[model samples]
Target: MNKKQSGIIVTLVVLIVIAGYLATKVNGPLYVNDSDFNEKTAISLKEGKSSSTFFTEATLSRDQDNAKTLQNIKALIDDANTPKEQKATAADEYLAVATATQNESDIELALKAQGFDAALCSIVDDKVEIFVKSSKKELSKEELRGIQDVVMSKTKLEKIDVKIKE
Candidate 1:
């Protein structure tokens, strides 16, 4: 590959790796200071601390970020300077990211449809981190199992965590 092709490939790989590391763990001591956690905010919905506004904002931010990234990838794919191989690879990665984004939304909606007050689903590589809100402070065994069933049916990811809020 030419220098330009190699550079583009490297950049795409790095972005994919970083995206997968975004997160899904909410069980930890609350960090009042913003610097204590990743700026992405989606990294951990703060377990029991998430309010409806926070949940809405987090999902909105995540989707906006994905849209921006997808736009950049599309530019690369359309660039005349991009090699054929690079374009093909970029297209595949673009599709993967887009599909994952849609899957996350779908999972959330399905969970809500199942009767949860609010739901957030994060798909990080082979794992999925889910947080659901309800009036009850504790989730029953059946409730937890039902959440898992919704996710499993929607996605085949290996590790799924239905985090117990707080």
Candidate 2:
């Protein structure tokens, strides 16, 4: 093949590979990986720093997802083809999402106040799930109880699950 033709083929192959890698990355789960969380937590602990210091990217992704969800719900509420009852339901769902997002922030702040580095809360379909980043990488029974107490008190919901990550 001519040098120019060979160069074109190589460029095309490189582009294909790059596209495939990006596709997988975009499609993967949005949550922070265990290794990343652990590494950040270790460094923070070593430096006597809070987990929030390293939380920017994960928190931004979570906020973006939350915004997208709210936007989608708002679109449903505003759609002309939607029935009145459905629109009303969508409005309620939107409120729920907004409240949940606020509650997540409240929980994160509360955890931080109590000395945690980072925390995330998600409320869905009557269930609340919390993820906390602790220096120890795991929660003691007392810590779990305390978290459950805080979440239940804030959300007024009986169902809660809390996970601690490094």
Candidate 3:
């Protein structure tokens, strides 16, 4: 090939290589073909803690929001004044609330994707613990009931130790 033709071909090859690298990096972890996805959260659950879906990608999405929530939850745990037992209890409460919110959101997204009109089920910490305004609202009674059933059923869980709130 002539010098000009060789130069053009070299440039095109370099560009193609760069483009191929970018494509692989972008699509490497999409899990499109996989049936399940899961990533570790900032706060590690207790050893016995259980989750509905073993591999969950929805919980992994909106990571920025999760980070902020985790920070706030940690602060709450730090701010609590009590004995070790009390602190542990408080931490468990916090985990339950946080996990419930994340789990509910993941469930909502999945349900919505499957053509179910879904809504956020408020995390029920306790009878006295009123929900703050930040929690997502229930979309409908039927959806809420459906979520309630799922949450209560204790089936399709990745772990067996985590207790479902009734």
Candidate with maximal lDDT: 1
Tens digit of per-residue lDDT, candidate 3, span 79-157: 7465677667768866775676666566555445544432233333431111111123443556445544554542234
The residue-by-residue lDDT of candidate 1 on 1-166, one tens digit each, is 8999999999999998776555323344322333554755444445455578657776876876787788889989989999999999999999989888989999999988988778888888889999787767788999888888887888877688886432
> What local lDDT does model 1 show for residue 137?
79
Candidate 2 lDDT by residue in tens digits, 40-150: 444322324445653655567577768878888887887899999999998998998899889888988888787777787777778988878876866788888788878
lDDT, model 2, position 154: 83
lDDT value for model 2: 0.77
Candidate 2 similarity to native, TM-score = 0.61
Cα deviation of 79 in candidate 2 (Å)? 3.2
The predicted structure with the larger lDDT, 1 or 2, is: 1
Off by over 4 Å in 2: 1-55
For every candidate, C-alpha RMSD to the true structure in Å = 15.1, 12.3, 16.3
Which ranges in model 1 have alpha carbons more than 4 Å from their true place? 1-50, 164-166
* TM-score of each model, in listed order: 0.67, 0.61, 0.32
| Candidate 3 Cα RMSD (Å) | 16.3
**Model 3 clashing-pair count:** 2
Clashing pairs in 1: none
